[model samples]
Target: MSRQHTSGDLRADRRYAYAEACLAEGDAAGAAEMAEQALDLAPRFAPAWLLLGRAREALHAAGGRETDLQGALRAYANALDLDPEDVLGSRLRLAQLGVGDALAAISPAYVRALFDGYAARFERHLVGELGYRGPTMLCASIDALAGAGRRFARVLDLGCGTGLMGATLEGRFDRLAGVDLSPAMLAKAEARGLYHRLVAGELTGFLAGEAAASADLVVAADVFIYLGDLRPALAAIARVLGPDGLAAFTVQSHDGAGIVIGPDGRYAHADAEVLAAADAAGLSLRSLTPAAIRRQNGLGVPGRIAVLSPGLA
Candidate 1:
């Protein structure tokens, strides 16, 4: 169902639809006026609030009006308050505006909703348009550390969206399991039949339910960008890995001391933050090398592929 339909008012829905059409036609002023009317009729409509916020943001971009930006912020805050799960991703917008602290992690509801909507076009857009090579590059990083043709008895693919990583490591593991937040993504992965099992849940929560030392290898390709603080997930990965197990993942890289939420709504981590988190989680960093995970805005995004093993106490 469309978000506008949830308002339960035919008139409000018509206004909202008109607002969306105006926005799509680059008529921000018209959209804003119509959205305001929609809000007047359905004051608590979260999607209308989001549309108003976006229209105000567009106007601010064109006119450079501080008041418009502030208005956008208030609209977004109202939407977030009405939908704390943040299915509309207002928190990311707030972070991009530099008005809110980078969230420790993106809300699962947001991720799930985003991927569910993008599932059908994800691979084409990511691989063909964005030139995403995260899975292949991460696998190469693992092979460089573990030696080519190294095999594992059990492997876990964290945030295993569409099983891209699983496809890369198909014959390299005796057993493979996957976990992801989006049911739509998991359904695609299941269709690939590369994983022995595919589960749908948040990464850390899924890891918490697994047996200690159960996985011989864990891989997260282009997954950590949604996470600001890496400690919790790192610790959970450590707990789930066997003594000889290794964990490998890719993260957007930055030069700052900690994590930063980029304007693109992804988290970029400094090397210091990643090292500290791995050390705290009792994981030995075997490799941390510069790489390009994907392309954004016609440029390669700088990133790091880190491979880690269980550290002795």
Candidate 2:
């Protein structure tokens, strides 16, 4: 951190600069080699960690070492931890890993904050680049429920990034509230002129704090993936629903009967698991439909939308 000038500093500088240039030109291994040489001369050169991160990423991207991806992330994380604001290093690692921009980033603290950052351009990147289907399909499923005359005077939109779901359901509800964890995404949703109120909080806890048995209809579009086990969330939803209250939700599904979290931290739940959770919560699954998130290369990933109502009702 001192930025001191030394006798061998000139040699170290040249090699470090060469490593970066090689990385920029797509020679990741060459860049890594140059960086090692520079580090040999100047053991404390912080910039070289960044160079090494990019090199390892390129190696990972080329499928040069799938087995080493975890190790690569650790190396990149070490560099970032040392220099929290290492822009180049952070950019390469997070971008290649594809963790920050998606729903996985949504949370209770203004859960929309991360989504809001991507809100202005969320749809474009989702549909065009990353093949996002959770949000759109969630909207569609909620609309179907409304069409079945499951209208409400008070509605809650959980994880309402940019108010997309609120916009789709506004016609069916006299009052609409959108709650999310990110302030940034809420800003965009607020600007959309859809929801009557916007709040920042975690999905289940926020839902729990509201006036008891208040919401007649609830829609959680693509929110369940963030939850590994659905029982806790399902229990909360049941609390907010009155005797006749109805809820519609979306969940990624696998072919079998279990739940698993992918490397992305998004949980994919099976039909039986989803059903069991609903049952345990004293809610009856009125409908379960197979759906596709979006299509890629003629194959669509499996997902489901479930409509639930309290069993005692």
Q: Best-fitting candidate, measured by TM-score?
A: 1
Which residue ranges in model 2 land beyond 4 Å of their true spot? Answer: 1-70, 76-113, 127-150, 263-265, 296-298
RMSD of each: 1.7, 7.1
Which candidate wins on lDDT? 1
Error of 1 at 298 (Å): 1.3
Provide the overall lDDT of each model, using Cα atoms, as 2-decimal numbers. 0.91, 0.71
Give the per-residue lDDT of model 1 (tens digit) for 1-313. 3422378888888899999999999999999999999999999999999999999999999999999999999999999999988888888887778777675437788888989989999999999999999989988889998899799999999999999999999889999999999999999999998899999999999999999999999999989999988999999999999999999999999977788888688999999999999999999999999998899999999899999999933
Cα distance off (Å), candidate 1, residue 91: 1.5
Q: Give the C-alpha miss distance for residue 312 in model 1, angstroms.
A: 6.4
lDDT digits (tens) for residues 153-256 of candidate 2: 99988888777677766567788998887677788888988788898877777887888789888888878876667898889888888787888888878876
What is candidate 2's CA lDDT for residue 123?
Answer: 70
Listed in order, each prediction's TM-score against the native is: 0.95, 0.69
